[model samples]
Target chain A: MTREGWTRLGLVAAGIAALEALCRTKVIKPLTLVPPSRMVHDLAGLLIAGDIFDDIGQTAIEVGGAFFLAIVLGVLMGAAIQATPRLRRAVAPVLASWYAVPSFVFYPLLVALFGLSTSPLIAIGVLSATPAMVVATIGGLDRVPRVLLRAARIHRLTAAQTLWLITLPSALPSLFTGLKLSFAYAFIGVIAGEFILSGGGIGYGIAYAYESFETPKMYALMLLVLIVAVGVNGALHAWEGRLLQRRQR
Target chain B: MTRLFDSLAIVAGILLLWTGVFEYAGDSAITGPLQTFRFAANLLGRADFWQHAQATLSAFGYALAISAVAGIALGLILGLHRFSGDVAEPMLASLYTIPKVTLYPLMLLVFGLGVSAKVAFGVIHGMIPVILFTLSAVKNIPQVLLRTAKALHLTPMQTATHLLAPAVLPEIISGLRIGFALTFLGVLIGEMFASQRGLGFLIINGINSHDVKRTTAVILIVITASVAANGALLALDRRAHH
Candidate 1:
């Protein structure tokens, strides 16, 4: 690891230690925040007990469904728009400002349309996640070198061949960015939908625990979410790093 | 002229789609665009609606102000110190990608159920982008410009105003645009989960009560307001960039 990496790890360790000390000293009430160690211990016990597996599975399905759909739809739509200049011009402003409107505001409307099921949650996830992928796809396509296309034409490469061999490779970085954002947005949308309105999921579990005054349980579930989010993001970051390194070679 | 025509066409397309959905789904599930617009107009005339709007707007305003000030200051400091920026950038980026909605319970516990919790939520969602943009903007400033300022024996304040501010303004505006959206989202989510007031609460309340018209209408108003604000900011962003 670099000096910056070491320093970051040290800083995080120090922060955790400080919080642990504060909790132990009773400066921070257990009601407000349990020690980090207690949260982890509770999380392990909860996992072993396996009561929360259903909620985890539900959330995972919703997020995965949304992520898959977003990538497919976003890439197809982005390509279609890119191929048509007039369509691109018409939608550019809308796409640019899309994130400004909280799409979750439409969650209730979705529930009304689809009923109180995973469908609404997945729909909301797709609504939030798809735009990021679409935007990234457009951006990626925009950055693909014009000379590469000209060379492909000169070589008489078919459209499919050119896309597979040249366009897709060139656009991989931006598309990876899109994939990362889509996953994050889908996860956030699903979890938040559950938190706000759904009957079940890890988010609902936390909210339920909060309302029932299960403070330790709530913190444990929260710790699970934190671990999952950081772990997935770290894995993706590392994978992207490796991919880029291989590409450079 | 073409741009105006395109904008009108897009609006028409969206309305058509809305009407089509309404036709397919029936009045039980959703209202048509015209019905929603009329309902929104009526809702806007009501004083009670403004109260909810005020609650959301004020919380959002406080959050945006705090995010801008604190994020810019921190970003500037980090950017000026090369080592600190390198160490902090990845940490900040990771934080940005996390599903912060999970932390809502924690915020509610700490700040309780009020405007403060909402504002804090908004700040957390909004501030990271600003810090990132400003930090990168400062880093991207030419070394020659700093050297020239130094050669002229300019004070820190003068150097900041004359050199740094103008250079970073464009990127900062871009960041603010994103921050504006996310902050609005954060506040709404905060309201939806715990609060008794705000547009978010109204929507959830309408859903719980099965008032489809009210829910749809409130959503329309919120979307219109957000899109209008973002459009204005986007115009400002383009001007800054050019």
Candidate 2:
């Protein structure tokens, strides 16, 4: 890692530490918000005593499968529409309308269709992920220079080869962007799924903690989720950075 | 022309599937769109619909007011102060990345089941984007404009009114538009997760009671409100650009 990266991270850590100390000292009290120190240990207890790993693990499975499905479908659909000019014009407007539909409104419909379990989570994830995936894939395909497609055609590359070598490679960056966004949405979708229907996901844990008035535990669980999110976001950033570096080489 | 047909084809295909599935499931609650639209219009004719809308819009008003005032103040503060901005910007950005909908429970506890909680939740969620956008806008304010104001010996307050306000007004307006959409999303989501009465409550009650038709109606109402809000904001944004 660069010195700059380490320094920026240190600054962030310092800021969090200062906030934690303020909370501990009663400077930020009457608020009684849990400091990061208490939060970290309490969060550790939640994982140790609580079935958080199982809940989070279950959520990951549903979201993973659903998001994967969306990417596969979205890329194929996006590419198909792109290849056929008539289809592209038809699909874009419809997709845009779907995009504007407040995603939360789908929960009732999903609950009716899927009836809890992993089904609802997957349904919600697909609903949320598909639009972003489709949009990004379409945008990526559209962005690839026309000359490149023509070159592939001139080379008489097979359809599969054309896609694998020309289209997919060209669209990789946008695809990565879509994946990052879809992953986040999928997480929300899973949480929403857990909220309704039969529950027992991390979302359910959070909701249960809230209803039972386990404020500290609820606060602790939230702190963990926040950390996990930061970790996941950082992981994606690093992955993308490495890919960009490899591309540069 | 053919593309238009293709669009209709997609809609028809979806409807066909929707009808087939609903029929097999043997439920009239949500039914199909056409049936729901008729019911939706009937819903509109009722005094209850207007009352529900009034409640929702009033909550929205409070949230919007909070978001606007808070967003501008925070945005300007972050924008003008470079060192603080540097120290805090990445952290804020990271926090933004946390899927906030998941934290609805904490917000529920903090704000209670009251409308103010709903408003405050919306404001916090919506404020970040506005802050980032306006901070950039302020940073982009021309050096020449500042110099000109100083040369005129304009007081700090006068300079703010004459120079900064005029310069950043358009960007601020744009931020407000974005803020409105996000605030609506946040408020409505909060209302849905926990609330006594609102469009969200109406939908949840409708669902719990197996009132699919009513749920569908509520969904339609929510969508229409979203569309209208988006349209209004877009128009406002365009007007502000001049």
Candidate 3:
């Protein structure tokens, strides 16, 4: 095994051992904090029962819907701005400043508009994710060599043809980055919305467990969230890598 | 000057579109731009808005300060050591992927509700980026630069101050920018979920009471404050990089 793999395994093992000892000695209250072993056991039970699937499905749908909205709106906005250099230059400062605004602030507005439904969650995700997508789209396009466009002009290619054949492909990496960012941000927004709005999601599950003092269940759910996030991100990254390689060829 | 005009024109265009939308929606509760501006102006004059704004900003400040110190220190340690970096970087990256919001209940369990809990949440939100940025900065330091510093028989402290610090400042600033936004979001979310005070609480209170004007006013104030703060930070970062 690679050194990094061994190091990670050793650290995880040590962490688990420490937690077990802490729980066994009653140094930490097991009621408030479940041991790692118990957490794994509870997670297995929940997976076997499969009741959490509903919440997982709801959250996934919200995130996916939001990401879809962001991609459509953000790409259009990005394309519009890029097509007009003047507008892009004018909006750059505004976008940069907007980046600092905590996206959750928009949730109240969404809830006000959409009420206590999954729509608000999805809206929150879209609102937060769009900026990243727009920025990435612009950046990706900007990185496309000017010489290539000149070559396209030399070849007597129409603007539409040149854009379809060259610009989009060249900007694929940055576009993918924007998509990745949108997905992650959308997921966070949806989860936070669920926590606040009592929407059905893993976030709501965590909150529910906490309120009822189901410490082990809460831990299990948090672990599940971690796994899902890691799994999705890993999958997306691998997909991005393959796309980039294909573009190179 | 033309660029300024272009920006003004765009803003005007957006405002016109926004007004049209507001008019079309025809919701008496959701005010148009003029009313929103007037109401937001009134909110700015109110002591309550200022108090809530102070609460939010103070929490943000406290968390940012704590995280900056701890993140830089720990980042330096981990970055300088191959063994630690190999062990901890993956863990840190994974932790970053998990929404810090998920850990709020845990934070509340440990710190209880109020400013401390919010600050703790904010620190966790902010610190990871700083650590990751700093670690990468340290890892990316040119070997030639280190060799030059060594040949000069520079002290460790000197090396840190003169060589390492300047080399990493740009990345650190970028990290700080991300950290500030995340910390602000963390504090805002924390306050929204469980606090009795702050801008978030005000917004929630406004929402619960169905006071659209108040909620809109608070949102406006927050966005303005956040944008203004971000602009200042961007200015600072630009100056440092230059």
Candidate 4:
């Protein structure tokens, strides 16, 4: 490992050690805080029990469904808006302003309409994330070089052909950034929806454990979430890195 | 004038779409804009809405203050040192990826089901971006500025206030805008989960009782407040950038 990596590992180890000591020594109440070792042990037990997988699967399916919807709808809407300067000007301020509002305000309405099912969660995810993708798509298309369009026109390329071969390729990098952001938003929305709506997923698991005062299980569930988040982030980072490499070549 | 007309046209188009959807779906709960606006206007006269708004805003304000102080301090400590920043950057990034709302239950446990939990939750959500942005701002300071500071034999405190603060203020302000938005969202979520008061709780109560008009009104209020706050911040950010 690099020096920086070693330093990070050391710091994390130190943090864990301190927490273990704090919990073991009873300086911190075990009722409120579970030591890392115990949490890990409990996590292993949960893994063996395997019931957590159902909740995980449910949350994953919702995330996937929401992300798909966001991408499809967002791209189409953004592309259409970008194609017209007047439309873009009309909507840009509204969209920018909307981005700041906590869309969770709409969550209650979603629940009222859809009930305590995964549908509400997925709907929230789509609503929260689609805007980011749309904005990114518009920005990406805006960044495409005018000269490229001129060249395509000179070559007598059909609008569809020019868009598919030239515009999309040029905008791919920005769109990917948007996709990554959309995933983060979707993940957050789904988890928050689960927490508030209280039906399924790791969020509900955590809330359930908290209500029942299952400290160890609660911490373990939190750990599972952290692990999943870190794993996905690392994968996304690696994918972006590979794309950048290919683009360079 | 044309832009104004265009914007109004788009707004009209959206209202028309919503009306069409409501008509087709025939869901009484999903009322048209006309009824929704009337309900919202009625809510303006109610004292309960303002009380709930106060609760939400107070929690947000306290959380923002704490995070701003804590984030800037931690950011400076970590950012000013190359070795510490390199060691800490990846760790922070990993933590950042985790959905912070998942930690709300933990906050409730630690701080109890009160304003404290809500404030703590908001701080957690808002503080990370501030710290990361501050760190980057510090790291990206021009070498010439640092060299000048060193050559002048300025004390650390002198350098911090005179050199570092001015250089990083704009970026920090911009970061605070995001921090403010996230913090507001966190407070809202916290209120929704367990609070007995706040705009979030008001909406949740409205939903639980199936009071569509009240819920819609609260939703509209929340949206308007957030959008207005964000617009103000955007203006401030633009001025700072200049």
Candidate 1 runs further than 4 Å off: none
What would the per-residue lDDT of candidate 1 be over residues A14-127, giving only the tens digit for each residue?
A: 999999999999999999999999999999999999999999999999989999999999999999988889989999998999899898777766887789999999999999
Q: Chain B of candidate 2 versus the native chain B: what TM-score?
A: 0.84
Q: For residues B68-166, could you state the per-residue lDDT of candidate 2 as single tens digits? A: 887788889978886666555655656766768667765765677878777876787688878877887888899999999889999999999989998
Stretches of candidate 3 off by over 4 Å are A148-173, A240-249, B13-29
**Ten-residue segment with the worst summed lDDT in candidate 2 chain B?**
B24-33
lDDT of 4 by residue, A100-165 (tens): 788876676677567768898999999988988999899889988999999999999999999887
Model 4 chain B — which ten-residue stretch has the worst lDDT? B21-30
- Each model's DockQ? 0.72, 0.34, 0.51, 0.58
Error of 2 at A123 (Å): 0.7
Cα TM-score of candidate 4: 0.88
Candidate 4 lDDT, B1-242, residue by residue in tens: 99879878977997897677567645445666788889888887889777888899899999999989898888888888988987877667667667888887668768999899889888988898888888888989999999999999999899989999999998898778878888888888788875999987887787778787777777777877888888898888889889
Per-candidate Cα lDDT values, in order, are 0.90, 0.76, 0.83, 0.84
Say which prediction, candidate 1 or candidate 2, comes out ahead on DockQ: 1
TM-score of each candidate structure, all chains considered together: 0.96, 0.82, 0.88, 0.88
DockQ for candidate 4, C-alpha atoms: 0.58
Tens digit of lDDT per residue, candidate 2, span A170-205? 788898878777777777677766765547777777
Report the lDDT tens digits of candidate 3 across residue range B87-205.
Answer: 78867866777777888877887788899998998898889989988888888899999999999999999999999999999888877887887888778878876689998888778
RMSD of each: 1.6, 4.4, 3.1, 3.1
Q: How well does candidate 3 score on lDDT at residue A74? A: 92
